[model samples]
Target: MIMHDAPEQTVKYLSLLGQQFPNQQAVFTEIINLQAILNLPKGTEHFMSDVHGEYEAFLHILNNCSGVVREHVDEDFGDTLNEEEKDNLCTLIYYPHEKIALVHAAHQDSPTWYKRMLDQLITVARRLSSRYTRSKVRKAIPHDFAYIIDELLHTHPDENNYRVRYHERIIDSILETDSTEEFIYSLAELIKVLAVDHIHLVGDIFDRGGGAAKIMDRLLSCVHQRTDIQWGNHDILWMGAAAGDAACIVSVLRNNLRYNNYEILENDYGISLRGLVSFADRTYRGGERIDPLMKAIDVLLFKLEGQIIYRHPEFDMEDRLLLDKIDLEAGTVTIGDETHPLITSDFPTIDPEHPYELTPEEARIVQKLVDEFTGTDHLHSHIDFLYRHGSVYLVSNNNLLFHGCVPLNEDGTFASVNCEGTWRSGRDYLDFCDHIARRAWRDHDRDALDWMWYLWIGHRSPLSGRNVKTFERSFIEDKATWIEPMDPYFTLTHDPACCDMIMREFGVQPERGHIINGHTPVKTTSGEKPIRADGKLLVIDGGFCTAYHPKTGIAGYTLISSSRGMRLKAHEAFRTVTEAITHNADIRSETTQFAAAERRIMVADTDTGTKIREQIQDLRMLLDAYRTGLIKEH
Candidate 1:
């Protein structure tokens, strides 16, 4: 029989593949493994948005895996363990080292207590491990306890009577070796790791709640699991600041001062506010109701912002250049058809002819702040992680995740945005924004750094869906002038077809895909629902920061996509971490399941499954090559 020859590249690729598989036996083994993996249950995806520096809340939710850990405990011990016992077990998994100490204090280091806790924890771990391949579970275990954990999870006492004694002896050994605490800690970690397969942070991991750096530190430690951040406008402001944008740097400082997040800047990131403090003291007097530092930073921010606006006429934010419109003598600023009275007539730094130019003193202070923000290694490391693990948007498992709107016109059409001299809309515009944002970090040129500022507040910016009224709100006493109008996309998204069009534009099947949004808080207090567009879009930002809790009527919203289906959870405010660890105060959450009647989802339906199938095909090809003698194998 005549055999057909393969292309040169195909032959070379198969030859390289043979190096990994080596022989037909190895190829067959891998193919079988891949096939088995394809039939397993799909891993759960946990989606959160607008964490907004609520580090304690975010950390607790993360440790609990959005209550998946508790659910596991409830499932395994619902009938066996009482409510108090279950709650304690859940708390133990969340803070093992701390909870263990407390347990020792109350129970006097009882061996009976340690042994009971270990058995219960192992049961939960084993249940979670059943959903994953043995190899994958082993990889997630700590290196020091990998062998012990693997054996404990996989070896069932029911397999043989000998195995029963073996399991008991292992637990007894752990108790005798004074390693109960260590073993329990390892089990707790493994349960946490296995509960949630992937974490999707829709956006706004920085700003507001005063512990963004702490939140970043916690996220950085999760090397064992998958996590991705979709950049929010607030996150972009910090990114731009880290990239040396003067406007962005002061904007960050302004917010920190405004929200009283001075500790985050001065203590966490070690950025000195002394320069601004000294400058504010010398610049502003005591009569103003606003803090002197707030007034000082606002003036500096407006000047820097005006400079950027003057350079980029394309930004169409000429109206925001209000310093030029200020009449210092009258203490009023003309804004288009209306003239609003300034809250204060303190314009010591404004030169009538050059309203955007900073005075020599003002320039020196802001420059120092810019240098400090850019030079801080800790700040840079966190921002570097954001750039490494974040993006403009993410399409995972058919759902499109973005921090803000897909800018739309009033007629429910994708809005054309002029990005980098070219007009693009929808996905194209977002792609351009993403490209320029990366350039802002990579090149740090004048234009790119300026683009980062635009992404933070520009009306056309998809990341920032509303025209920010920062200047108007700060200076003008008129509440009417402080209304920041949202983009048409916010209104247009009320229509399901509009959301479907957005999904299709992003190359997702509208019927199955949902747009996960973050920038806007869903006002549940005022009878607003996060699920909108007939379930085509979900706004998961249920106010993670305290400021919006009154408006949103909930602490936060998290989405879970598991093998069963998707669900949205509204979590009540986390009282305090101390309360959680001591009193077992888990964030009381109400869950709303989406399409609960749908068929169970399996690994064969996932993105990872697609890649695995491709691998299986490649291995089959390598096996053929080995049999045909086309490639030699060891």
Candidate 2:
């Protein structure tokens, strides 16, 4: 409504369209007079218009003549319009036409007023659609967003409705609940099991889920209907989409099918679900129509919340800013009125997996997308980067968060973490960890990768950048168990270094405090072994996130306390623990499809495993390194 100036150019073009149909019959007959015009049989017509009886435009048009909106425009077919054509392509439809069509619609959401318009348009377009070439039809339509119900059926929400973010991590119960209501209902159960105060989101809350719009509306309705939310990758993307950012839009288009501009929507113009129905309604009348509402449900899911669930136990402003930095890199920023970013820009398309180098134009586009990436804008947020929301780090009173180990000089002495809090040892430990985490993401940095995985395997020399990426393949694929040095694509395996870095950089390491973290998804132990080669490091990321595992359960998160040390717990209140864990991974029979329970990080338990203890030692190495660093600096 705020954008309703209907620019002068739009007025001029709309006037021209009206002039084309001077008389009511000129408009009405376009439908019934199909056979002679578009090469159809005697029974059909073309150029249908389900006007809102008054010949004036109304909101009902969004539903009545849904096809050919901005999102669904195709440039080549004469259906797609440029930025200018988009404003100028309005038509004159009478309300009466849509009311009569009501009888044809199966659901009530297609109100009586809109139905009449649809019915008439369907009859006319089918008969005459043959006459006009696709080029002409495309030019006439301008935007694809007009076709709402049409594309929904064509895309077949049933097939495209699988998961995207919730892939490998297994969380049962998440897939069963259909509506947002059901999702919220089960969420409480997941939270109880996980043991968190509030959920954190990374961003991207739109464009890939059922009832995405409604879910978003509900999430925002905290004051309206009262709901809790954690940002996710999709949410920030939605912000950009709603604000109409072409960069973010294009990235999503390349990935998703339901909203792809080129392949599915028949144009690179924009989205047009309503326009799709109108296209079908006119082109193929009386053909079994797919359920548009069902399709809309899928469209709504891209706006889901609670995906990255981070909670803060307690902290001051200065510390919060540090938290923001980690989230920014993770791509979970969330600033209001912010445009979505192009994820492919700053980060390599596949981070060393890219087949070809990008040209300047392509690179610019990527940069534009990445530039607009909005990190969290919350008063408490510490980060300031591109689009991010879901990815979060909690700093509870009892828990500490850090990324790397204390630094080690070329001679292999220790460098102090020197960060903050009582017992400042954690701070020094944190620094060395930082070095490894960064190294792990770098090329041929086996040491860092291995450190993160808590595995002490040495790497072959001259590990090429290409080879480093190859080594990381298993780590990214998350099948570290089956991974071997021979596979060497660059191991996603583990980098004990990252944890140390996070702690020292953010000062999450405390002398006497426990720690909680995400990011590192490696099993705390391997075989029955304890190889504490490098240093003492502790990693608690037992793979609580679905982005890693298709079958990761709900309670992968851990809790460490001096009273009983640390233990694993489930996030029972998180709607579908399975859905939460799986993120969007396919959830077949949980029994057969899922296995390999990543053990929770446990301290002081017989089952803690040698790797866990080894990790603890690696964490300690960070402190030692930091201390040495302080000594050298002095």
lDDT against the true structure, each candidate: 0.90, 0.27
Lowest-scoring 10 consecutive residues by lDDT in candidate 1? 1-10
Q: What local lDDT score does residue 291 receive in model 2, on the 0 to 100 scale? A: 34
Question: Which window of ten consecutive residues has the lowest lDDT sum in model 2?
Answer: 44-53
User: In candidate 1, what are the lDDT values of residues 1-634, reduced to their tens digit?
Assistant: 1123878888889878877889989998999999999999999899999999998899999998888888889899878999999998999999999898877678756898889999999999999999999999999998878898888887765756787788888999999999889888899998999999999999998888899999898889998889999999999999999999999999998887778898989998889888788888888876787767888889899999999998999899988988889999999999998888898988787899998899999989888888898899999999999999999999988999999888888888888977768989989999998999999899999999999999999998989989999998888888888899999988888899888899999889997888999989999989999999889889999999999999999999999999999889999999987788789999989999885626778898988999999998888888878878888889
**Backbone clashes in each candidate structure, one number apiece?**
0, 234
- In candidate 2, what are the lDDT values of residues 75-192, reduced to their tens digit? 2224434543322221212122232233235353333323332332332333233333333333333132224212211222244555322221112222232222222222212112
Identify the leading candidate in terms of lDDT. Answer: 1
Which parts of model 1 are misplaced by more than 4 Å?
A: 1-5, 158-160
